[model samples]
Target: MRLYWVILCLVYSGSAVSDQKVYRWKDKNGNWVYSDVPKKGSEKVKLSTNMLTMPATDTSILTPNPATPTVTYQAKITAPSDQQTLRENSGSVYVNGLVTPRFANGFQVQLFLNGKATGPKQTTASFALRDVPRGEHKLQMKVFNDKGMLVAQSAVTTFFLHRASLLNR
Candidate 1:
C-alpha cells in the first residue's frame, strides 16, 4: 500500500524527512492503493504530515491596559497669561499654577523658566521667581515623586518681561 511505503520512508530516511515523496496508484480491482514502489501507472504524492505547530505569542500585547483618570494627574498654570508683557516688580515674578487631585505626600512641583529648571522643589504649585533678567521667557510645570520619578506636567507658557532703565529715575 502507498501508506505503508510512506511510513517506511519516513522511518528509514532520517535526514531527507521533509524531502521524501511517495507514490499512489489503483490496481486491476479498482481498489484505492498507496505505495512507495514505482509502478507503470503510479502518480507521485507528497508525504502525509501528522503534526502541526504554532508560534509563541506575547500575551501582554493582546491584553488591554488599565485606565487612569485624567484629574488624578493634571498640571495646569493659572497665572501669567501666555505671551503677555509684564513690568516686573523689583525683578520678581510670581508663577502660579494649579494641580488636580492634590499632590501626593512626597511629591513636589518643579518650575521650568525660559526652558531652564528654576528654584528649589516645592510642595505647592505657586513659586516666587526673583531677579529674572528682562527678556522673553517660557514656563512649564513638572511633578516628581520623592524618588525623582516624573509623574505629571503642564504645557509651556511664554511671557515677555519689560523693565524700564533706572536712568529715568
Candidate 2:
C-alpha cells in the first residue's frame, strides 16, 4: 500500500521515466551507488518501470459510514524512563503504556521522536524503535482517529541513548 504513493509520486514527478538511464558503480567502501549521470568508467544500468503495475484498491475501504462515534483520550509514555539512560548496544528501545478511557473506534497510536512522527499508525499503545542514535532524544505518542484527526496525546518523555565508543577500541 505504501508503494502506491511512492510510485504515484515518482510517476507524477517524472523522475522514473522508462527511457532514463541510471549509472551504477561501487565506491571505496564497496557500497553500490546509483545516479542519473554516469561518472568515468561507471556502468550504465537499465531499470524497467515494473513498479507501475500496482494492485487496485477497493472502494469499500475508502468510504466510511458517517454514523461512527468520536472518542477522545489522553495517553502517556511509561517506558524508557524519563531522563533515563539506555545502554543497548544496538540502540533499540521499547515504549509501552495504557491510555485512559480505552481506545475508541478507528483510534491509532503514533510515536514521535524529537517531534517527528515515527513507525506505523497502530491501535495499541506500544512502540518499538530501532537505531536510536547516541545522545538525548525526546519521545511522544499521539492517538488519531480513522479520519487522521488528532484525538489523544502523551506527555513529552525525554531519555538519553548511551552507546559504547568505538574510537578508543
lDDT of each: 0.84, 0.85
TM-score of 2: 0.56
Predicted candidate 1 versus true structure: per-residue lDDT over 23-78, tens digit per residue: 88988899878876778889999776655678888798677666744445788887
Worst 10 residues of 2 by lDDT: 10-19
TM-score of each: 0.55, 0.56
In Å, residue 110's CA in model 1 sits off its true spot by: 0.6
Tell me the lDDT of model 1 at 19. Answer: 64
Off by over 4 Å in 1: 1-72, 166-169
| Candidate 2 CA-lDDT value | 0.85
Off by over 4 Å in 2: 1-72
For every candidate structure, what is the RMSD over all alpha carbons to the true structure, in angstroms? 15.3, 23.7
Total clashes for model 2? 0
